[model samples]
Target: MAATVEAVIAALRVTLEEAQKSREASWKVEAVNRWIGQLPGSWSGRWRRLVLKSDASGNARRDELVAHVRAVIAFLETNRQQIAQSRKWWPLRRRWPANSPIANAPVAAPASSSARPVNLLRVRKPMPGIH
Candidate 1:
């Protein structure tokens, strides 16, 4: 279960968006480090060595690091097609399911898979929470 191009891209995008939305340095660092751990093959090791954040006194410093990484992500977006078809990625691919269990979880079947439609909208309860 190696990491597909879609998984990598999605993970990177989600991490960036979440970190951008949060003002806390610790939150940003944790999000980024988690992403780095999920990176495919050597990428994980490489990013782990990089400086995401240190005992910084303020959020500004940590945010700047994440901002700089966004440029690299933008480049990745532009070259997505190329990266998807690259043979190099085959060996470097990571196990996507290992990092995202929710995505791979079994979808529960309907309790009444054979039954017809249940018109819940028409048979509404006498308004919930009413005495």
Candidate 2:
């Protein structure tokens, strides 16, 4: 009976542990990124199979686009640490660079929150809109 009670207590304590909170935060960010990453794959598949025209009023389209841009900027700021700045968004466990000295060895967690996740996008015509 005592052993059982102790086991239950330990299980309950796991949620309150620092490691658990860190893992939860890390997982939340990773899961979100994984979902975002899937869009390109699915979009390309759909794009190849569909021939569709999109049209909308300048104001309506402008409003929608502006809203999306704001949301994206907020999300990026909030999740900057969780993102793999180099596009490496490796499973946080596999976040290390292969050529790095420690990369050959297994890393239990990331090096540091400040070290990763910078969202950079490039386009041939950039400056007018890069910001």
Candidate 3:
């Protein structure tokens, strides 16, 4: 019975590791998808069909995950080069200026009462005639 319990624990550990890897892979795929979607019109669709088609299988094997990530990186690099070469693609790189009012707005401070500073070292005076 002890051997069986140990074996079960080991199996659960393996299962947990696999689940974590699967989740990490899924997150990577989603991130790549988001970047691809940000590309100019029809480019995202074309790239998705060409580069990320294999990811539709829903398999999270490590090799498959690496392949998907590599494909996405390659696609992004190529697209970036193309965008740099084309004058019409400048809009893709244009971001709102950092100095904008919304971006410069100060964060709100935490709410607190406006109280006088406490003096921890102050001695209390003895009450008159109370001795």
Candidate 4:
């Protein structure tokens, strides 16, 4: 009777462990499904390649990379219209502050300003009417 009871208890424990494991696996699959659904088509090929590579090593880093890429892609897609509109519009013009000395610096005068003008009105008398 004791042996039978122990066997039954062990069986129940095994079944419970199996159930928990299945639940965990189901959750993982669900998460994966959600990710795949939300991911953009452009990134699918790259992500699929990374997943295939990582599957052999069982490392989930590649999956994390895929998730990051998917998030960035989704963000860009959502904001694309806004970005386009912003590009079409000119950026706000910022007026220079009146108190900013750099903005009020004296501009250098052109070099021509320093040179004397030609004396066009000078009377050139030929030396003692020698002309």
Candidate 3: which pairs clash? none
- Those runs of model 4 whose alpha carbons end farther than 4 Å from true positions after fitting are 1-60, 88-106, 110-131
Segments of candidate 2 deviating more than 4 angstroms: 1-60, 85-131
1 or 4, greater by TM-score: 1
RMSD of each: 13.7, 22.8, 18.8, 25.1
lDDT tens per residue, model 1, 42-69? 3444333432554564233546656745
Scored against the true structure, residue 80 in model 1 reaches a CA lDDT of: 66
What 10-residue stretch in candidate 3 is worst by lDDT? 1-10
Candidate 3: regions farther than 4 A off: 1-29, 42-46, 54-60, 87-131
Error of 3 at 42 (Å): 5.2
lDDT, model 1, position 4: 55
lDDT of 1: 0.57
Query: Can you write out model 2's per-residue Cα lDDT over 34-126, one digit (the tens) per residue?
Result: 223332232344212211112442122323333333444354345445442323222346556778887677658855675756556533544
Ranking by TM-score: 1, 3, 4, 2
Quote the lDDT for 106 in model 3.
93
lDDT of each: 0.57, 0.36, 0.48, 0.41
Ranking of all candidate structures by their lDDT, best first: 1, 3, 4, 2
